[model samples]
Target: MTSASELLALRSELTGSLVLPGDDAYEAARTPWNLSVDQRPAAIAEPADIADLQAILRTATAAGLGVTVQPNGHGANGDLSGVVLIRPKRFDLLAVDEQARVLRAGAGVNWGRALERLDGTGLVALAGSNPEVNVVALAIAGGQSMFSRRYGITARSIISVEFVDAAGTVHRVSDADDAELMWALRGGGGLFGIVTEIELALYPGDAIFGGGLMFPAEVAEAVVTAAFELARDEPELGLDVGMMHFPDAPQAPPHLRGRTVATVALVHVGDEATGRAFADRIVAVAEPISDTLTSFTIGSLAAVAAEPVEPMPSADFGVALDGLDDAFAREFVDAFTRGAARGLTRCGIRAMGGAIADELGAEFAAVGATQADALMSCSVLLFDPTIDVDAAFAPMRDLAARYPGGATLPTFLSSGATLADAYDRDVLDRLAAVKQRVDPGGVIRSNRPLG
Candidate 1:
């Protein structure tokens, strides 16, 4: 065990605060955005800058403590015991180059802040539905973004990555400088090192046709079939269909109280006329109870899925599908509706194809290799004080077992999933080689470590 005197000596070398177990701020410091996870880290370090981060790494290594880094902690797993949790929110720097269509964001920057910086520039970053998620983390983990259909996964857009390795050595890597590390960092999770900043390429587009179309629970099967057809027929359009169960809680909207609904959310990158035509095709499938589809600025992209903005406790299970065929669609609709009745709050299947499947070169390869046609996921909020969270997740688990697919995305894999479950043997071997080269000591550890 590290003595208090040693801990204090390590703290003296940093320009940031260190919260031990007894510190008043320790609980909040260790708390992640996903409230369901309870991470009791040995110590929490709030690094003010890169220099402080280096110090923390060196100090932790000297003390023989494993280091885990989290910017906003969106994907926090509950096994952080005996590890030094480093929160680098102080490196919140964002620089946008409109002329070159590039964005350089620090580890502390989130998608919402990056979008704000790119406003009115006729440019958009490949960002996920949750605007508050950390930009660096998402990019490193191969983000599935709003524009994933047109542009591939978000990790392929990275121009460069700046990180400190386990040995406390700083390295700025790109496709040219370190091709192997670049490939691994793109979607290899946080095993190699602690990334401090990333430079990403941005696309040129301002207006997008984006919104949701909600249908009554009775027509969910038909809706899923229609949405699948749309995804297959028009791979250029970004689309996701969600089967939701809204409880009769006081916090829920009055109209949706105690009801199950199927929502088809979409975003098209082209002109408003083409977008309207696509929306019309969906409307032709079934009469929507609510239609919010309209032309909107890219800044408002997060509203397309209507994902909750605030932090909350959530558990999710995901599986990749070869395609959402008629049989699978019916099965999904029935299973989701039944699961909702059993306490599942949200279940969604996102269409994945188009540029996502294209060969983006070995250096740009990410976890979401263009093979899977769709991704199905289920989530539940742990809000009720008396509810059994594990029991609530049972239905979703059964659904996954009944309709198992190829490989799952590392970005959306559950805590129980292993690296082998997300990657092929060849890919896993390559990732392990890279990990051995960069973090041979295994000083840096993440939720999914490359073996």
Candidate 2:
């Protein structure tokens, strides 16, 4: 354990604030976005700039302590004990190069702020469904966005990364500077170092025809079948489908409370007329109870899923499927409904093909190079203390076992799986070599540690 005097000495060298275990701000500083994860680090440091970050890393290394980086604490896995929790919330930097069609964002910049900054610029950054997620973290984890079908994974769009390795050496890594480190940083889950900033290529076009179509619970099987067929027929169309179970709670809206519904969300890059025609094809297969498809700007894409903005306790179960056949679709629908009956609140599968498979080269990045047609995930809200978490996840596990395909994406991976489960042997070996070279002491700890 680090002594109080030693911590004070280290704090004196930093321009940022450091909170000890007994400090009033310690709890909030160390808390993760997922309320279920209980992380107890020895200290929490919020770096104001790159200098402060480097000092923190050097001090932690001298003290023989591990370092865990959490920009917004979205992917916390509860393994932060006995480490120095570094939150770069003060590193507020955002720059757009319209001429080059690129965006340079700091670790603290969220998708919401980035989208707002580029509102009417006729340009869009590759971002995920939840606008509140940190842009740097998502890019590092191989972000799957609304435009993934046309543009490929967000990691592939990275132009450069500015990070500080475990030895306190800062590096501006790119394909030109260091190809191996850059590839590892993309979708490798922060195993090498702390990423302070990232530059990503942006896409043109400001608008997309996107929204969701909700159907009654009774017709969930039909909805799933239709959604799979649409994705198979038009791989270029950005699509996702889900079966949500709203619990009977006062916190939920009156209309959604105690209801089960299936929804097919669409995001078409083509013109409004073509998007409408695609919607018509889906509706013709099975009429929807509620349809909100319309022409919208890229900034409004986050509203399609309407995921929760506030932090809450939740557990996730996910799987990658080779293809969604008729038999698999029926089994999936039945499993989802059964899990819903057993307290599974949200379950969905996002289509993964087109640019995701075609553009993701085997050696390009650590993720997104999958042969799977779609990725399915089931999540259970843990608001009720009496709920059985294991029982709620059983159906999802069984469903995934039925159609296991290639490795799972790092972004959707949950705890308990080894690195081999998420990557092939060769990729794992390469990642290990990078980890050994950059972080030999294994001071940089992440959810999926290659070291």
Which one wins on TM-score? 2
Over the stretch 1-451, how does candidate 1's per-residue lDDT look in tens digits?
4645556787888888889888899888988888888899888988887787788778777787888888887778766877888887888889999989999999988888887778788888998867888899988887788698888888888899999998888999998998888888888878888889999999967778878999998888888888888889888799998789887998689999999999899989878898888878778878999988888776777766667877788777877876468887787877777677667888888888888877755346647464787887788877876666566667666766766668767777775566676788888888889988998888898866653
Model 1 CA lDDT for position 21: 84
- Please, what is the TM-score per model? 0.95, 0.96
* Candidate 1 runs further than 4 Å off: 1-4, 366-368, 385-395
> Model 2 scores what on Cα lDDT?
0.81
User: How well is each residue in 239-284 modelled by candidate 2, as lDDT tens digits?
Assistant: 8888898889987888889999888998887689989988887788
lDDT of each: 0.81, 0.81
Native RMSD of candidate 1 (Å): 1.8
Off by over 4 Å in 2: 1-4, 359-362, 416-418
RMSD of each: 1.8, 1.7
